[model samples]
Target: MSSHVKLRKERGTIAECETQVKEIRSQMAEQLKSLDLHVEMRVQLLQDLSEFFRRKAEIETEYSRGLEKLAERFSSRIRNSKEPQHSRKEQDLLSSVSCWHLILNHTRQESREHAVLSDTYSNSMVVRLCHITEDTGRLSKKSKDIGLQMQEQLLKVTSELQTAMKTYNQYHTDSMNAEGKLKEVEKLEERHMGKSADPGLGQSGVDAKQQRSSTLKKMERLKEKRQAKFLENKLKCTKARNDYLLNLAAANAAMNKYYLQDVCSLIECCDLGFHLSLGVTLRLYLSAQSRVQQSQQEAVGVLEGAVQGLDPPGDQKKILEMNHTAFCLPFRFEYQPHEGDQVCVVSAEAQVRNELVTRFQQLQSRLSSVSLETEEVNKTMKATLKALLDSFSFEDFSSSDSLQTSQSAESVKSSGSDPPGNKPNIAKRRANQQETESFYFTKVKEYLSGCSLISKLQAKHDLLKEAIEKAEGIDSDPSRLQCSNRSLRVRKQRPCSQYNHKLFTGDLQQFVESSGQLIPLVVESCIRFINLHGLHHEGIFRVPGSQSEVNEIRNAFERGEDPLTDLTDHNIDSVAGVLKLYFRGLEKPLFPQEKFQELVECVQIENKLERACHIKKVVGCFPQAVLIIMRFLFAFLNHLSQYSDENMMDSHNLAVCFGPTLVAVPLDQDAVSVQPRVNEVVKTIIMFHEKIFPGARELEGPLYEKCMTEEEEYW
Candidate 1:
């Protein structure tokens, strides 16, 4: 009975101990789980804090850079203005007005910092909660060491949280203070703006307004003075005009009084004589002639009386008495008649009459002196006449000229009848006939030559007309042509075609059309120029065509014929090659490859607006030839796209065919070296086509890929 009681009690005790151990283990596990959750939260909060710091630094740097850029832009605008000093002053005023902007920015920065700190503080609380969770596992294992370390870490975290909170509160206060200052600054700036808006009001006192008032007063005075001067000048001009009129009238009166005497005398003479009606100009002219004739008659009478003995005046006296008439010259002034004026006219006439009488007396004295000389001349003339009569011979005076001419001819012929002096008449006639025949033959030869030239010119004109018709027909056809075509292509192949078979037969027609139909003719002309100038050395630069054929083609071109249709494959290729040669001879390339690369880079800017601006800047610097070539390539690509749609050569095929050929590459450099450049240019050209014709399909093909890859490999 004693043993059973003991066993029962022991079992009860053991159950109690087991129950206690289970409760303790459950509590510790719960604590450990809570600790782990706190640790994870702390770690995440620390990471977030680090990220916030990084973002804050980035924002600050970006803000600073943006501020500097804005300032530079404003400064540049001010400096570039036409009024530098005035603009600078305005810039200063603007800066003063914008002072509030800086304050606002500072306030905003402070607010942001405060917000970030407040967030850090809030997150630090979660970290602090991690420390409150006890780590019982450390209490069990190395209890003192683990507990002390956990306490130290917890203290450190708590201290950092406290520091962050303090900083947050400080930033919050600063933000509020800055915001208050920003308001004050804005109020001050507003007042300054109002004051500046009024031109009459200035910070430099009222000096500017006062100066403007003084300048206005001076301008009013100056205007009044100018008006007065103008009036004085007008008065002077009026007085001078009146003086000129008076002088003109006086001069007219003087001219009529002195110079118009002939007119007055003519009027009087007409009235005094038989008054015949006549035109004024005719009467004046006839009156002057009559006066001159009267003077001439008086002088002639005196001379006749002095030179020869006079016959008695019988029938002439009677005829003169029958036609006797008298005329008088009236003296009159243009204005009021002056007594002295008439006296001057009467005295002048009287002087003339007295002079005439004195001249006649002198003539009579001279005639008496010359009378002896006249008698001597008459006696000599009579003796000469007698000698002439004694020496005259009147025999055979009635004979005809023909009879005399025949007699003279016979005498000359008989005189030349000697062997040395007289050759056979037949031989002389033969020589004359030979000379005449040779001259006529020479003239005939010249006429035949001229006729041949005219015929050749006419044939050329006919050929040119035929060529025009042929070219028109070819142009009318829509089908593309090839060297192998039987009807359209030339049948006769030249030696040059065999040697340059690839070039001659290549598809160069697309690029050649834009240059002109005369490109081949120009090339031939250049080749001729080269040969004539000795620019072509043997085997160095030989043009590939028979000389005669080239000359004929060139002549036809000079005659304004379109010879494009007449050009064979061989000639076309030769001309295309020459075209390239001409480009190579230029001092600078048409499109510099280096500059094109820069242009591509410019257009490749990421920003669309910036890219457009850069494109304008770059394109503006391009040479004229480059611009033209770019336009041509753009057109070529558009046409090529159409050609592709029509099942002709596609974009890639055309690019491959003509891209490198269009741009002149130096022979010293391999074609492979510039193949990529040409391909890029071709792609750019296609892009331009897309821009011009937006509805067109984009370029695509395996051939394009192949070409691009080939070019890329070269690079």
Candidate 2:
């Protein structure tokens, strides 16, 4: 079956054939030696005869197997003569029928056997001689035919050559006549030198050509350099983008882990059950509601920052109108409220956030520096502060070892098994250690009683430090060297707002770009988490990207076997890749379907902790404080301001990319939100998606309107 083996077989057969050819030729020669004839003609006839014989053998060989099969099948019938017959008459049938069949089969078998043998051996010799003879004959016939064709072609060529020769001769004669005229003209020209016109025309043409050539070369060089610089800039941008993405991913991963842990701890702490009343429960709920709304407001603020940063042109009056139209689609759901139900929730929510925000501002103003550091700090403290505030009883400051001993004593008293008349023994035992124990308790009580006075002094010192710092930063003296020093806020300044301004023209665009940059990194992190946790779409932390959202339009085109024409083409079924996944702690409702709920929890945790610790929305992000209390307090506040959940979809009826990064969450019909984060998410996603796959927003008018409305409300 292998090629090498088959090739070897073919080669061996050819060699055997050549050997047989020599033997056949020798045998034919001996037979021909007896007849006298022309050596070449006799040789040709022998070859022809052999060739005919070989061809007959080849024909038989082609049918050899079929003949053998037929022979084998009929041989048994011929031998037995007892197989089924068509005729009714069985007697007097000649036995020679069997003999005749046998003879026929023998002849067929002989024919096939001879063919195989001759084709395998004799045929080669016969074929070779016949081929040689035929070749010679064909050569002779061809030579004669070629001689006739050549004569005709030669005559045609001779005629053409004669015509050409005559033309050349005539042309040469004319050229000689022209030369004589030229010689006469030359002599005339020499005699009349100043008679010629158009002198230096050729030179001028040469100069013009040279100038054009030089200009082309300069243009080519300039174009090449421009193209090269463009390519270099593109490379630099790509690399910068990659670096930014990597850093963003790392920072985000660390932040999210810490955020989740803090949220879980804080949630558990806040959920701690104790003695409660209806008023207290209501108060907690109201506090929680306000905290949630403030989060929504701040999230909107962040989104607004992002939108303003993208540097959108301010002449967007028409754009704004269109955006509004897009957002103002008719309500489609059957349970559409009479506006009261929705308004009730909105109004209560909004009022709470506003009130809470105002209170926080008031509280901040009351900070005389000490209270800023310590929420429980007394504003008008004196040396008696220790007696009034910092003082604690010995029992309140009891050591764990002492408390354990007291508990043990109570347990023993309950047992009531002490011997009678042992009062003297017990008194003697206690009398020795009473002085030492009393001394210890007294020292601790004195320290606790003296603490408030020290604190008051410390508070006063902190107040002075803050005043000095604030005064140093302020430019109250207009005449001072104002020319040199710059203010914190400036035109095109550094430490760019991490939170994108969603309204200042470019904020939404900036949010989109910033989040767009985040997407790839987020996707990679998602993949990494999925792998590390062995997670599917089951619970907390699912895969975040959606291939369908990314390539829905392309998918249609691919199905149709046509090229996708545009990104935001009406046929686009998807607007983004994965935007929803699990936050680490809240494991229920994992995928996009449960995104709204998870978002609520993430934002809720972010909110409660902020309210409990007096963290406000104005400075909701992280604080510079290194203390654990401050770190956690402001950390939760930072999360709350993200509007991670509070301001997201209320209807829960749309596709949302629910992750820490995406601004591309597209809110759908009946989609409600305490805040309209999805609108911004969609805007950001579309903008960024387009940067890679250009012209995505071939139909972005509606999106702009929806996003603007949501952003406006938040702002």
Candidate 3:
């Protein structure tokens, strides 16, 4: 009975729900049709505005031409009239008519151009707004569809529940009916037993009672099974409903998050576009300023020339006043078309230039205001983004945040009242943030399309480009030739060698700062210099700078001039070259290039004892002075590394750049024959460089292997 009642209730609810669904579908369809109509209206509005501007321009042109024709007819009538007294007055009236006509034409042209520009800007703004509205409309439609889907899911679950309840009822009724018949039969058996006391009849009655009890037990088992099945179906329906709800909530949240993220991204794009526009505007402003300044200079020059042409005996103050008048008076027009026309054009140009300067100043002020507004908008956007990030624990918006981290119904139920996936506070905060974000993006779009900020910026850029071309043309003019003047007086100059005298003074700090990694080239040059000069055994070397200049520099230093500050690039190179030669004069050559391979091979031995013995033997072959100098060089490099990472002179990398220079081939052999030797010496230098440098640690195993592999290929 309960099952039948549930079935009836479900049947009634389904029809009602279907009617609601139909109503909702109709409402959504109407909304979509309305949105389409709105879009079409916006497009049509733009078209109408465009047509209005076209008609306005045509009217202005026609009006200007009509005025010109009227002025001509008036002038002709005045010229043809025979009245002498009226002739002069008519001539004046005709001149006024011509002037008025010109003014009307100029004003009309300016107004028409301004109107067209304004219409274009307005049209662009409308289009941008339409795009925003369309996006919102789509979002609304998607939300409606999700609602419809949820309704459908609820109805399906209701139908399944009705069927399960009906099955449960049928099983239960059958079980109860069996028990009722068994009770009736037992009462009948007691009445019959009192009339017939036969043993066979009594046994038959006992058998009948036993059979009924068995039937009752079977019915109870069958009912229990049906009840278990019904319970399972109920749990399934409940789970399905919960899942549907969770999915709907997740979808809603996801859409909101997506919209907010897109808005943030759009805001960022706008910020970038604004900055780029500002940069372009700034360039144009600078170019315009330059051109204006140049024009002003030319105008001032013309005025100065006019001043110079004035009577020489005139009073100085009067002459100055006359010059000012000459500058200001030329913009006036003469009806006679006299020689003053050229001066008038020039003066008019000067006035135009002045106006341009004022306008440029205004442009700069507007740009600054725009920049400040853009910055404020960006800050607001970032703050909203930060709030969103804080409220929702999303690692990144680059992927689908909802799809990847959506919580199932089971997880939500397990987590109890406060599910980890969705927080009420967070959802509320996100909604607020989303609203603010939409408003900000709307503002950003308004600013972008406002008075055509981007278009104005582009115009400025084009103007700047044109100005640059003009400037370039002027620069290329043949009239402005570079003078080939030269000074005849002699001055004391430093020799290259004198600058290098300090290299052997043992100033490691100066060496690192000046030469950096160029130390290798300097060293190579120095070594070749020593070899060429046969200075290997010399205890002293001549300084390279001019003697007089060197003495002067020394005196200045003695007078407390700082050496490092005084050092120049040439001086640094010369010092490095000199230092290289100092190595040749060592008690033993640093690498002992003659035995480079033997030394490296000794260090490469597998047996520690054998390797140590061979290294000792190789060291003993060189003079003790060479070992001392090698240690000093490595320590200096380590110190230099601390100061600058460039010269670095680290064990592995320094060897690569300077390796070949360190490898000295025999006089009778070419470099190719000594390639193996160079490799060995590079290895030897790196090995000892690590061991001798105080702070050096053994190379990491992988890095050491990579270095060795590179070295083999390099050699």
Question: For each candidate, how many residue pairs have backbone atoms clashing (under 3 Å)?
Answer: 0, 44, 6
Better of 2 and 3 by lDDT: 3
lDDT tens readout by residue for model 2, 424-449: 33343234223322332233323322
lDDT of 1: 0.36
The sequence of per-residue lDDT tens digits that candidate 3 reaches over residues 1-715 is 9647645654554445445435534543443344344335535654564455456445644553554465457656656777796666665568786686566544444333333223222332233233333433443343334333433433343344334333433343344445455555555555554434543348888887666666666656655666655555544433333222322233333223222232233223322222222222223222322332455776556654553453322332342353332211111111111111121111112323444344434654565566567666565455444433332232111111111211332222232222232343334434654554464445544443332342343333333333333534544322122456653322222112223224333333333344332232233333322222322221112223345543443444333232222223223323333454444333334567567667656645666455545665665565433444344454333333332232223444334334454445556654433444354444454455544322313211111111121012100
Model 2 ranges off by over 4 Å: 1-201, 251-255, 268-715
Q: After superposing candidate 1 on the true structure, give the runs of residues whose Cα lies further than 4 Å from its correct spot.
A: 1-562, 565-587, 600-617, 645-648, 657-659, 662-674, 687-715
**Which 10-residue window in model 1 sums to the lowest lDDT?**
393-402
Model 3 spans > 4 angstroms off? 1-6, 66-202, 209-715
Task: Please identify which of the two predictions, 1 or 3, would achieve the higher lDDT against the true structure.
Answer: 3
Best by lDDT: 3
My TM-score estimates for the predictions, one after another, are 0.18, 0.13, 0.26
Please give the CA lDDT of all the candidate structures. Answer: 0.36, 0.31, 0.38
Model 1 agreement with the true structure over 1-715: per-residue lDDT tens digits:
8435644554444344345334433433443343344345534644564455446545644553554455556656656878768665666567764684565444443333333222222332222222212111221222222323323332333243333323333333343344455555556545544554566646565886565556556655655555555555434333332222222233333223212332222222112111111111123222322332455776655554433332223322332243222111112212211111121111112323344334334433443334434444444333332322222211111111111112222332222122231223224433433333333333333332233223322332333333333534544321122335554432222111112111222223322344332223333333333222222121112223345555554444444443433333324324334434444433444455556556446534556455545555555465533444444334534443443432223455445445554554556644543554454455455545434321213221111111121012110
RMSD of each: 66.2, 48.9, 37.2
